[model samples]
Target: MSRAVLVEAPRPTIAAPAAAEETPAQRPSRRWRRAVSPVVLVVAWEAAARTGLLPAEKLPAPADVVAAGWRLTQEGTLGVHLADSVTRAAIGMLIGGVLALALGAAAGLLRLGDDLVDPPVQMARMLPHLGLVPLLIIWVGIGEELKITLVALGAFFPIYFNTYAGIRDIDERLVEAARTCGLGAAARLRHVILPGALPSIFLGLRLAIGAAWLSLVVGEQVNAQTGIGFLMMEARDFSQTDVVLLGLLIYALLGLASDLGLRIVERRVLTWRRGLRAT
Candidate 1:
């Protein structure tokens, strides 16, 4: 008879279940909690105002803001000011966005170019856009050019740096594989590098978009322009807090709308990345 030995293999540890029991709808309820949480806050605000918890002059309820906004819209004042702000922001963002894409793509492709321009880029970025108001007014004579230039500058740097970082950080092995597969420089860039760097570019654009809006508002306040910023300033001079608040609310809503659009674009462009696993 031969003696046989039995060996035991180690059992793999079972990980916690990753798929939550919550349905997709339930998963998104968390977002609503945050979204509608503001409703609760607004209610509390109205209650406090009515109950004399706060001076009515110091704080206006949502109802008052709504009424004020409605009044301004009916009067056509808000529409005119809001259009001015929107136009400046849109034009500046378009110009800066194109330039940033071109510059960032160049910097990403050429290390020498990045080194050459990066220092000046950093210097320009360090100077606050608002701080340049006086200089722009002097150089551009307080015209539309001043405001547009300010917004363009603010919107440029974020996209540039993010794009450069994106291309520089691509997986080395992937590039080597492209080289091994006989991909030319242009083909490798077009096929792999640009696509891989897209997420970073979008991230930069989101930041740039916000900056563009802010810079436009600040620039609008500087000169005799029609804009939300001008509306706010004008309302402030007259102690019309409701109009000022309305202008602010418009800005917030517009920013949200633009960001939502960008998110939609991102979803389409990055469909391959959604819920996908990395190696």
Candidate 2:
């Protein structure tokens, strides 16, 4: 009996490797790396333009575009156009954002609301919103209303869809837990739902900002008296390629700046989330 007795040892557990920490010294290098591609592209473009490989008549060099922007700045027209564009965008965003939050919350939180609101919204979103320009022109005429309406329409869907999706995507268990904890509906919405939905909301916000700018560009082109789009149109009539290119560059920079700002806000708001990072 003793000779037949045997024993087994426990297996050793292995721990996962920790993520590599990024030092302060690495941050500047990382930022520099990000700038490399844009720098190279600009250099290549400038070289091509100088060599006549890229016709200046078609696409102006970066330096020429810079000069055009400087000239516009000196003329005082640039500041006025910039201010007008910002005001239009801000007004439209306010209108669109309010509507989106209301509709999206209703549709997301209430079964009856979803049944009533979702179908029309889904159908409407299927149509290219920008394609409504002609109809909008007739309905609102070529004025501030036309431009603001177009921007509002463009900004609406992204925020609405994202907000709806974000609220719906929240865990049922979390809602149940909140209920079990005897939290009121308002409290649950404020603490549990909105916080949980913020990531998607911010994503929508970023997208909406971009859509606002794009809509502004088109709206301003509808016999606009001022704005970057109008400036570009004026330049086109005069065959000023450099000014047109500068307008395009300004648009790109504005969009990029907006997206970056949103990203910073998102990171701050979602500090609890430990998302995967690109190496």
Candidate 3:
């Protein structure tokens, strides 16, 4: 008994906690899984076109669309049209984005600004911006100005609405806390307000990008020159369904790419947020 009292029992071995199982959302292959349905749909479409179930004239086969794209590429026309479209989009986005940010900030931050700005913006937003194409044509003519203006209009409303909403929706307690911490108005805005509103702003940006593309489609179709929309219109005149479909495909791809890029930026910028996971 005395010898046992002098010795301490060996400590129980503790196995390291088993690693948590990876969920589908955590898997690297999740992105590839998302592509499966689209791939299947495309394959079914190709099969339908080959079997004459889907008329080629009505919706050209994917192969024909690819061929048309390759032909355009060979002729060097695709590069020019692509460049022109990209340039217009870039310029319009820049102009629209700047105006939206400035006005939205003013409206959101100041009571007088909100009273003055929100009413008119709300009224203007109610009018279908796309429906203003005729007025835009009259004001600016069917040239680069018309296209740029249309795109800018399309890009403006979403950003303006979202930015105002985002800033307004921020918790007052956070602002109060910043004030209590001896932070001035500018510091509070930079540290607390902008970060809190970023998610909504990004959402608005994505919507604006889509709208810009939609406006560009209409703008290019109306005008007399180089762009995917113009190419599609020209192909329509010639009954070149393949080329028309190819143009549509290009637009879809561009929109998708832009959204994807924005998403990456949003993720990087909002890393501090624990926002909902797709699961």
Q: Which candidate achieves the best lDDT against the true structure?
A: 2
Order of models, best lDDT first? 2, 3, 1
Sum up the clashes in candidate 3: 0
| Worst window of 10 by summed lDDT in candidate 1 | 270-279
Which digits, one per residue and each the tens of the lDDT, describe model 1 over residues 88-205?
8888888888898888887777888788876787787777778878888889888888888888888888888888888888997998899999999989998889888999999999
CA lDDT of each prediction against the hidden true structure: 0.83, 0.92, 0.91
Error of 1 at 208 (Å): 1.0
Pairs that collide, model 2: none
| 89-180: candidate 3 lDDT, tens digit per residue | 98999899989998999999999999999899999999998899889888999899998998999999999999999999999999999999
lDDT of 1 at 190: 87
Q: Where's the lowest-lDDT run of ten residues in candidate 3?
A: 1-10
The deviation in Å at residue 29 for candidate 3 is: 1.2
Judged by whole-model lDDT over C-alpha atoms, candidate 2 comes out at 0.92
lDDT of 2 by residue, 138-249 (tens): 8989999998998898889999999999999999999999999999999999999999999888888999999999999999999899999999999999999999998889
